[model samples]
Target: MTAPVAKLLLKVFTYRQLAVGGGFLAGFGYVYCGIGFALSALPGYIILEDHFQDQFPKALSASSLFNFIGIAVLPPLLQYLKTLFGSREAFILFGAVTWHMIPAGFGLRDAVPRGGCIDRPSVSKRHAKTKRDLKFVNKYLSFCSCLFYHKNYAILVVTEFLSSLIYISWALFLVSLGTSAGLREESAVILSTAAGVGSFLGTALAIGLFHFQKMNAYTSCAVPLLVNGIGLVGLTFARDFNSLLSLTLLTGFCLGVNISGMIGIIPSLVCRYHFQQAVVINYFIDGIAYQFGGLISGAIRDLYGSTLYVYGFAALLSFVALPWILIWACNKDPNRECEPDLS
Candidate 1:
């Protein structure tokens, strides 16, 4: 529902005579788009978990592959449009393209539980009125409590938050970072697209590893994060376009494997009843981390006049999560670790 409105907003007021005001309107439109994406994606993951069962990893990998394909394609496509048509026309065309998601979204069906729904105790009229009044607050508290119900889950949440914070900060600034290193705008864009291509390839690799090697989810996620962090730190030494492109490709590949593992790990980390909650909470953390990441990275860039430090900070945070990942992986009887305490 909000998809067309969000696109229409971009089409109407993105860069007209409104100037700065138009920028604000575009920002507002992006907020709507973000909300729509979160709403759609969270449910989609839950649906995949419920329906795909053992095949969820492949399903998710395919989804990630397509996602990066768009990431790989869109920038160059937009650049081509801007080259031929004017900038305004490019944005307008882009907005028109986004409207397709509305129809695509219509095809999604609600997930049916593999074993059917579990019944919960019903409240009587006397207690219902009071419970209804505090429902929102109570639900919020319940969700928070569930986050730490198991040690592995708690670790996953923290790791996810840090990962989101680190990755989002650098990912958003990749183009600017390339430009800062003396690459032309077109070259920088190509550099960004290389990351997407790398991600697509990496996800494909993960799918193969999942089937053939029977890779451990924790190891898959943790190892890539470790590699990506080292790669980002090494990125500071990159001087030429090729060097920067190579490092970005490596980091993007790690990012794809790490994310595929992260999403696939959720089912193993929590019970079926909490799957939706886990997805919601994970994305909620992502949204919060994204806002903080932008502010932190921008502040460092503004204060120091360098994007290198931004990647440096991201690298630092990425390393900080490694210990927790190691701890989670080393823990004994991992499958039994997710079971809720009933005594």
Candidate 2:
């Protein structure tokens, strides 16, 4: 709902020239976009996981395919719009593009109604609170409590937080890094397109691997992330277009795999009842980490006068997250197949 509004806000704040504190306003708009994403994505992910459990990975990959395609295609198209129209008009057009999501939202019908013959209580009714019920400082205590119910979930969130902190910076700064390395603005845009193509290929690869390969969740996530870190570090040494393009493809491919694995594994970490809570909590933390990462990256660029250091720092974080995933995989119970959800 707020997605199109964010774009409209961007259009307004950026008209003629950037208004004072435009950067802050732009960030605020992105926050709404993030919330909008959470609202839509949570249901889509839940629906896919619940209905297509056997082929969830491929289904998720298929769903994400168009996202990568948009990433690959939008930059060049938007640049053309900026050249033909103006920044303000380009934003207006993009805001119109975002409006399509409203109709898409209408198509999301329930996979199975809760009460037909079983006479189940409504979700709100089931969880209804009384004045006597224990309360916390906020309404999110129940969701937050789910994090500690399983050690795997706790580790997953930490790994996710650390990885996301670095990943968001990579996506936001990739173009800046390209321009800093003496590429033209158009070439930098192409570099972003290359990354998107790489991500698309990576998603295709993941779909194949999930269909044919028998890798566990930990291996699926850790390997791609570790490679992703190396790819980021490789970017520091890429002085030419071809070098940067190749490395960006590798990095994006790894990112695609890592992202798919990250979300797909939630079903394994938490039980069916708490799945929605887990998803909400994961993305909420992600929203915060993304903003924090951007600020940190911006500061590093300001201090060192180079995006190379920013890329290196992001790589270091990937390395840091690798160990946690490995430790969790090693200590995972051999006898028990899955953890029981909190009742």
Task: Kindly give the number of clashing pairs for every candidate.
Answer: 0, 0
- Tell me the whole-model lDDT of each prediction, alpha carbons only: 0.77, 0.76
Alpha-carbon RMSD, each predicted model: 7.6, 7.5
Could you tell me every candidate's TM-score relative to the true structure?
0.81, 0.81
Query: After TM-score superposition, what is the CA distance of residue 83 in candidate 2 from its true location, in Å?
Result: 0.9
Q: Which stretches of candidate 1 lie over 4 Å from their true place?
A: 1-26, 116-140, 333-343
Q: How accurate is candidate 2 locally (lDDT)?
A: 0.76
Q: Candidate 1, residue 152: CA error in Å?
A: 0.8
lDDT of 1 by residue, 1-343 (tens): 7667656667776645446765687689778888988877877777887778787777888888988898888988998899999899999999898777777678887776576443443323433553465466456667554454446777788888888887787688888888888988888888779889888888887887766645564556678888899989988779898889999999989888877777666767766656667788888998999988888889998999998999998889878888888887886644322212110
Name every residue pair that clashes in candidate 1. none
Model 2: how far residue 36 lies from native, Å: 2.2
Model 1, C-alpha of 22: deviation from truth (Å): 8.7
